[model samples]
Target: MSVPSKPWDSELVAKWLEGRIEAAARDQATADRRGYGAEDDYDKAAAEEWVCRSLRTTARESEQAAFALRIKQLLDQEDYRITGIHDDRRVERHVRATLRKIAKMTKANEGFENKLRYQ
Candidate 1:
């Protein structure tokens, strides 16, 4: 779409670009609107990270952060970032569940080590 031309000296061009992007959002249903499956893997990871940082009111805030960090790290290793997903609550739940699984695995390993030491 053609942006209205301002005087050559006016930096209104940047503002025009921003407006176009906003209009695109208004015209379409973003991923979060349709749920987690709609978003790409990278976006999902980033959303999970944001959820950990932003969803402070959820239970076990520290665990959420850990999960977020883990997910973001994994995604980053694969070159990913959050986008297109607008729901923070769902992100928090996913991150929490992932963290719980990781925690269980770690605990199991530690228990095994302790038992080996006793033997």
Candidate 2:
């Protein structure tokens, strides 16, 4: 079951990226103040890369979280029979797996989506 995403909001992404970039700047400043020398530049680069990766992961997780909440709202409004699933644990597992799959697909499709012109 593919969950189609709403169109990407450039403003929302820009806001989120702004925060991440500011945090990275702060991190670099802290490292410099701690006497990071030439040899540590590599480590600094690696740390910055990690921060960027973390930001991307966080954005993906947040999207998944929003999707899951919407699903829950629908289930509640429609009065789905959770008991019919036999085990609540199984249903919970399935929900988690579905969210993970959605996150993965979002990341995988990001590059292709970037190439398209919306307007």
The local distance difference test score of model 1 is 0.37
| Regions more than 4 Å wrong, model 1 | 1-37, 40-44, 47-84, 110-119
Decoy 2 TM-score against native: 0.32
Cα lDDT listed for each candidate: 0.37, 0.41
Model 1: per-residue Cα lDDT over 65-99, one tens digit each:
35335444543443223454445555445555544
Best by lDDT: 2
RMSD in Å for all candidates: 21.6, 16.7
Model 2 residue runs over 4 Å out of place are 1-3, 37-119
Report how far off residue 35 is in candidate 1 (Å).
11
Model 2 lDDT at residue 35: 64
Summing lDDT over every window of 10 consecutive residues in candidate 2, give the lowest-scoring window: 110-119
Give the clashing residue pairs of candidate 1, or none: none
If scored against the real structure, what TM-score would every candidate get?
0.29, 0.32
